[model samples]
Target: MNVTLPPTRSLLVAGALGLAVLAAAAGGWYWYDAQQRRVAAAYAEVMTRVYAVQSPQAPADARARAQQELEQILARHPSATPVGEAAFELGNLRYAARQWAPARAAYEIALARAHSPTVRALARTSIGYAWEAERDWGKAIEAYQAVGREVGPKDFLFDEVQFALARVQELGGQPAAAITTYQRLLKDAPNSVRVEEAKQQLMRLGARAQK
Candidate 1:
């Protein structure tokens, strides 16, 4: 299967003041904006490295290069608009490295920097997964619960987050809570792909879901 990678993020400041009159009046501003775009261009290199690391054709050095590039982007663009993306990428890299604690930390940074609800929720999901990987069930539950509070049922990631929340509950030694979560998904998102998954989990737990 062909895998797709995240596209490059652009500098949010409008394109260079190409007009001569505006440029002359705002020479310093234009120079700063140009520098900003130059810095933002580093995200493209990070994207390339990310794709390489995630690809089946990935080299042995791909991960090392990706980690370095992501760190560079963070260092070089501390106030860059795509700092959130860089942090999220770092979280993904740490998760892939199996450094769950650092992964959660990076995701927390991403969440703090994220302006969009979807981005924040996605960061929370990653945080939950990182906690789950560490077998820190209570923390995972808290992170996943934050997702539920952040996003609505119809949100693009709602079903996925709910399913993960239930699994965290189950693995966290709270089968009853897991069962309730599963039932809620079944009732609220009956047409969701996770519906059958929830049912299967309920059955495995030897509990009947309240349909």
Candidate 2:
């Protein structure tokens, strides 16, 4: 008679197979999570390094290298959390280079994808500046107004948006409106450094302060 394997042996073999499958799945998940973290960390580090180089004389090659690295990271991990921040940084670089159109596009993309309200506000401000660079006073006013409303009256950025909006109003042939906005900003932001500037602008607009 031929010997046969015990039923318990087959049960043990099945259990081992199930355990192996679970282990493989766990390992794959861990690897994927680790990869995502690595990508995010790399992106943050690159952005920090790029921002740290403050000299106007900083080599163009360095900036180009940083951009290339950021591009590669973004290409590899399109959905990374830092991608929006990277786009914002790139927009700043382009803006500093006076590349208004591309800077505006990049800032728009960053604003659309930004997860943080602070970052979105910054992108909005930058977009307003880009419009100003292009001398599109109407668009600049719109952008500044949007940013001002979003940032609220108590925020530090309030003064900046107010100033930008006033300038846009002046350029849009609404000097009276500009004077009114400046006067309001001066009253609201009495301690702000821009208060004096606002007063000067009001004077130039022939707007006398009410007694």
Candidate 3:
């Protein structure tokens, strides 16, 4: 015969199980919070190193050390919230070292991982800069155009990317495309700081501004 527990005893057992689950969930949350804090602290320390490496007076070994630290962070916390920023910083570091291909690779990683639109825009534009530095105008134009297609004109980076694209088009022997891009920039972002420069470019290209 099966024996049934008394009502009060059964209630106590259920309540104990419920409390255990709640305790486990709270413990898990606490651990997660602590881990996030630790990751943030680590990211901050790496940023300090990055700043030092970027300084004009930095030691020759500073960049190498910073790069190592950034790499370690990436290896340890690939899914951390700051991973994209770390990748972007790594790209900037490589760019400063004149490692154009590596810089572009890092920027592509940032583009893939960054949740913030600003960071994504920056990474995309920086990829273009890397190609531009290598005098690969076609690749530079392609990268810069990706920024426009993905981020659009309403983004704060629009005018800057437009200017870059127009400059590259001119460099690549596409004067008509350059002129049109300049005119579009003038029309779309009339109040941008780049407005004066765009106007001058239009004049140089023998194209009238959109007013």
Candidate 4:
């Protein structure tokens, strides 16, 4: 004899399957949520340590603690977003100490982990500053130029990157290029903070600033 489940039994089976699926989805979401929270927490902790090192009023111990914490972040979260942040902070600390080479290395790490062009441009600029600190003018110009070449015109960093690139060109023995860059910036962004500096630099370079 053939047997079939009643309508009630069939409905119960379907409902159970639906509830199981819902539970599974809930569990998966919870796991993702927890992972995101962990990443956020790590970023926050790293920022705290970095700020401590950045603060001039912070004691020597604060610097030491910050270094230790940064190392831990790098060691543990090798691929997390905050690893880039930690590296960036470490670069700032080293730059403050005038340790040019190490600062460049840290900035490079930051560049590797940067998720956006804005962050990449900023890291490149910092690398240029490190090169300038070391008196490596050619590399400084290269770094700054890379930012201009890679970043979009719509980016907020565009003008600042150009200003930095121009400064590096001047320092790299390309005074004429630097003057041209400054003039362009003046014409394009009259309201920029760099405008006054550009005018001053143009005057120093014996170039007439446009009215």
Off by over 4 Å in 2: 1-18, 207-211
Against the true structure, candidate 2 reaches a TM-score of 0.83
Order of candidate numbers by lDDT, starting with the best: 3, 2, 1, 4
Worst 10-residue lDDT window, candidate 2: 202-211
Residues 48-72 of candidate 2 have per-residue lDDT tens digits of 8778653688787777776667667
Please provide the root mean square deviation of candidate 1 (C-alpha atoms, Å).
15.1
lDDT of 3 at 35: 97
Give the total clashing residue pairs for model 3: 0
Show pairs that collide, candidate 4. Answer: none
Q: For model 1, what is the error of residue 101's alpha carbon versus the real structure, in angstroms, after optimal superposition?
A: 1.6
- The Cα RMSD in angstroms, rounded to one decimal, for candidate 4 relative to the true structure is 5.0
Better of 1 and 3 by lDDT: 3
Q: TM-score per candidate, in order?
A: 0.81, 0.83, 0.83, 0.73
Alpha carbon deviation, residue 30, candidate 4 (Å): 6.8
* CA deviation > 4 Å runs, candidate 3: 1-14, 150-155, 207-211
**Which residue runs does candidate 1 get wrong by more than 4 Å?**
1-25, 207-211
Indicate whether candidate 1 or candidate 4 has the larger TM-score. 1
- Looking at candidate 1, what is the lDDT of residue 138? 96
lDDT of 3 by residue, 14-88 (tens): 999999999999999999999999998999999888987788788768897898799889889999998888999
